[model samples]
Target: MIKFELKDLEVFYGDFQALKGIDMKIPANEITAFIGPSGCGKTTFLKCLNRMNDLVEGCRVYGQVTLDGEDIYNDYDVNLLRKRVGMVFQKPLPFKMSIYDNIAFGPRTHGIRSKSALDEIVEQSLTQATLWDEVKDRLNMDALSFSGGQQQRICIARALAVRPEVLLMDEPTSALDPISTGKIEEVVMELKKKYSIVIVTHNMQQAVRISDKTAFFLLGEVIEFGDTEKLFSVPKDKRTEEYITGRFG
Candidate 1:
């Protein structure tokens, strides 16, 4: 199933094109990784998926991007589109509230008012994010008190509570320790069973391990996209091979 269809996607920041006529289809219920060196537009392209680029002044786009066959740009309610496409950034940005409240914020904002219902969502979201067991006893404590990795997981839970159909992660584990990275990778593996996931990563091994498919980007162009095993082991593009083999990036 195609969760997102990006066709001839051209992104520009004040006349400087970042993504040049890119075309891709993100599969439903799978993890797709976009990997490339800095300035290759990997992150820029990821931001386009959720229209995060719109937040930046002078950002412009050409071509069509659809979620579940509906044009997101054509929709007047960007806020509604965002609810279906949740994003997690590199830094773990938890609100200055308790862990429980952090997870409850979205559901509450969307009209989930009952305390007991909020409690169930908080617990379920935390469990899905693999952070409940660690902080279940400290729900009322400050979320900032958690470690960097824990904070990121809390953010993930916060995103999950809204029940997004697609999750966009931009180097989600970049700031974490190895153990924390592994834990988040495990969570990513589990999440693919439910939500379609698109990740932008600088960590080659993490991309290889966690993603079902891998797309190589360079200078805002998709060099190659294929199954993870094929893309890493036997890339069709010489550029992709060089980038993977460390010959060039």
Candidate 2:
């Protein structure tokens, strides 16, 4: 099933075009990786899925972006849209609070006030992020005290706390060590069974390892988009071939 469909998508920051006309269909319950060089608009396109780009000053988007066949930019509630599409950033951004509170924050904001309910949510979210066992006994500990990898997992748990239908990760493990990166990858692999995941990564090998579908961006447009294995092995575009082979970004 298609989770998101984009046609003639374009984005501009002030007068500078950041993304040219682009088109792609993201499948449901699978990992879609956006790979490209710096400033290739991979992150820009990911933000468009949940209207995060709208937060940018002078950011303008033109074209059709639909979620579940409904135009997200047309008379949609931004807050509710965000609830359905949760985001995890490049860096671990845990609020200055305990681990339990971090996971409970989203559910609380959405009107889950019961202590028992919050308890279940916190446990489930942390478990989903694969941090439950390590932090279960210390749920009251400050989230920031954890290591970078644990902090990132906490952020993931926070995003999952809202029970989002889709998860958007922007270089989620870029700052973590290899072991940490592997853990995040493992969590993401499991998440695809329950959530449609879209990730923007500079790591081509990571893309090859996790994603079911891959989109290669260049300049301000998509050069190739298809099954992950095919796109990497038999790229239809020379630019994609060169970029993946490390000839030129």
Candidate 3:
């Protein structure tokens, strides 16, 4: 099933065109990686998934971006859109509160008021992000006490607390050590059974390792997209081959 479908999508930051007329389909229950040089609109397009770009001043999006066959930009409530499509960023940004509070924040915002209900969500989200065992006994401790990687997982748990259908990760492991990166990758692989995932990564090798499908972007356009193995072995576009082979970004 298709989770997200984009047609003739364009994004403009003031007078500068970030994403040109583009089209793509993101399948449900799979991981899709967007890879390219910096400023190639990989992150920009990721933001469009949940209308995060809407917060940017003078930012405008054109064309169609649908979630589960419904146009999210046309008539959906912005806040609810975010609840359905959660995001995890490059750096781990945990709220100053305890781990339990960080996970409970989303459920509370959505009107889930029962303490037991919040407790279940907190535990489940942390478990889903693969951080429960490490911090189960320290749920009341400040979230900032953990290392960078643990903090990222906490952010992921926070995102999952809202029961988002799609998870958008923008270089989520870029700041972590090798071991931490591996852990995040494993968690993401396990998550594909339930949530559609779109990841933006400058690390092509990481993309090849985890993503079921890969999309190569350049100058705000998708140059090629296909199964990870086939696309890497025999990319249809010269630019894709160049980027993958380290010939150029």
Winner by lDDT: 2
Q: Would you list the rank order by lDDT, best first?
A: 2, 3, 1
TM-score order, best first, reads 2, 3, 1
lDDT of 3 at 205: 85
Q: What is the RMSD of candidate 3?
A: 0.7
Candidate 1, pairs of clashing residues: none
Evaluate residue 58 in candidate 3 and report its C-alpha lDDT on the 0 to 100 scale: 99
* Model 2 spans > 4 angstroms off: none
Whole-model lDDT per candidate: 0.93, 0.96, 0.95
For 103-173, candidate 3 gives per-residue lDDT tens digits of 99999999999999999999999999999999999999999999999999999999999999999999999
lDDT of 3: 0.95
**Clashing residue pairs found in predicted model 3:** none
RMSD of 2: 0.6
On a 0 to 1 TM-score scale, where does candidate 2 land against the true structure?
A: 0.99
- Model 1 over residues 157-189: C-alpha lDDT tens digits? 999998899999999999999999999999989
lDDT, candidate 1, at 249: 63
Off by over 4 Å in 1: none
